[model samples]
Target: MYKKKYSNKFSVAPMLNYTDQYCRYFYRQLTKKTLLYTEMITSQELLYKNPDNYIRYTSNNQNPIAIQLAGNNINELTKCAMIAYSLGFNEINLNAGCPSKKAQLGGFGACLMLNPILLFNIIRAIYNTVPIPISIKIRLGTHNKNNYQHLYNFIKLVSKKNYCKRFIIHARIANLNGLNTKKNRCIPPLNYKYVYKIKKDFPNLKIILNGGIQNLQEAQKHLKIIDGVMLGRAIYKNPLMLCAVDQKIFSVHSIINKKILLDNMQKYIHYHSLKNIPIIYIFRHMLNIFYGKPQSKKLKQYFIHKIKNYTDITILFQKLSKKFNF
Candidate 1:
């Protein structure tokens, strides 16, 4: 368990390819208080492959971060939770909301919503194995199970042991059979009212709402009804939105200096470059750092071109600073 309790009032969703360590590190530069999550890692991958490959990029600076794991087997989930706890993660999040076919085939993700007993057992096993907080990221329901009563009963069953107290409910129903992952995000109508009702009914459980929340103002509005809000694509597309998150959402007064931000990243990239890590791995996550700025497209192109030619990163930053008046 973390020495100090961390707030989940605001968070970035664990996107598969988007929420890698580089991205989480970049987001941390913008806001210190908002909780961060790693992209979902399956239990099988963690068990069979080198766990270090999955977690080596994590830094102590990324404190209060949670590792999202996907699997239905109680023993595997418990072992994964222990591994995450040993690695000093602040929380272990079960990925019950992912609608990807890969997740469906594994008998996890959104499908877990249909098997409340097994889901509850998995949670209980993990809770018993690790002392860190355990959270579940889930949709309201799945396919025909998409009803308030069904959702209510599922929540009622899972929350019985009190092992999992926090549930991050994506307000959309996941269509496991007919929809692709992309369609699952858009085709299903979001029923935020059902989420609000859950909060009203389960006053003791911490409820964080997810899905279609776009900005801080909207997050504040939802906070009026729930414990927190989780944003995914919105933050990935326009990261600058995080520039004001600490001050507006967490009530922590802080100033973001673009120069300082770039300088810190430059140093970080250079250090990694020494270890033979390609700059593209880190730079790709940064193309939007200058978002909303004048001539951002040209800047991104310049970056891509320089990286292709293997230009010195320090020189690239000097050029960027001069060209952009950073």
Candidate 2:
């Protein structure tokens, strides 16, 4: 059990293909305090496959990271929570907000919102099995039931157990049948007001708002009404923004040095390379590191070209250092 209180002031949302262990390690180079999460791993995968494949991290510095699991089975979830806790994860987050067809077919994700009783049971089971904190990531409502009252009822029922105290609410109604996962993120209007109201009504429960949060300034404004703010594509596409997270959000001064960042990534890539992992796997996450910069396109192109003709990790970084003046 993690004895220290976990801070949810700011976090990187657990994206499907984007927030893997390699990506989390890269993000750590930019910000140390911002909480990170693993990509949503289903309970079955953790049980059937080699668990290390899904939860491996490069170092203990990745501490305070949460593992997001998607499933509806009470026993599987409880077992998975124990596995995550045994592996030293800081928290277990149930995925009740994903609107993907795959998740729907598996009887999990956003569809779990339709069965608040089962969701509550799953949360209760996991909470009982693990001493670490448990959190739920959810959408406001589903389909035609997209309204304030429905959302309130869902939270009211789920919170009745009081097993999960932290809720990460994505301020959008999931249109499971009509919208694809990509469309679900945009087409459904964000109702941050509903999230704020949740905080108002459940004053003791921690409410972390997720959806359409673009920058740290916007996050700060939401933090005034809620406990935390979660960023998804905004941070993944321009991860350099995380460099300011420690200072601006956590009030901890951190030196953002490009040289230090390069050295750390170079060492990380080299370490993975020795383990027979492809460099491209690690480098792909960094393609957007220079986002919004004047040389962003050129740097990205150079990375692609080098990755395609990948040689030694040292050679690749040396070339990048000279060509991009890193």
Tens-digit lDDT track of model 2 for 1-326: 44555589999999988898889988988898888999999999999987665699854667679999999889989999988888889989999999999998999999989999999998888877888889999999999788889999999999876898999999999999868999999999989999999999999899999999999999999998999999999998888889899999999999877777788999998888899888888899988866877878988997898888886777887776665432
Error of 2 at 221 (Å): 0.7
How far residue 207's Cα lies from its native spot in candidate 1, in Å, is 0.8
Number of colliding residue pairs in each model: 0, 0
Backbone clashes, candidate 2:
0
Worst 10 residues of 1 by lDDT: 51-60
Candidate 1 segments exceeding 4 Å error: 323-326
- lDDT for every model? 0.88, 0.89
- Model 1 lDDT tens row, 140-187: 999888989999999999999789999999999999887999999989
Candidate 2 lDDT trough over 10 residues, lowest sum: 317-326
Q: Pairs clashing in candidate 1?
A: none
What local lDDT score does residue 29 receive in model 1, on the 0 to 100 scale? 87
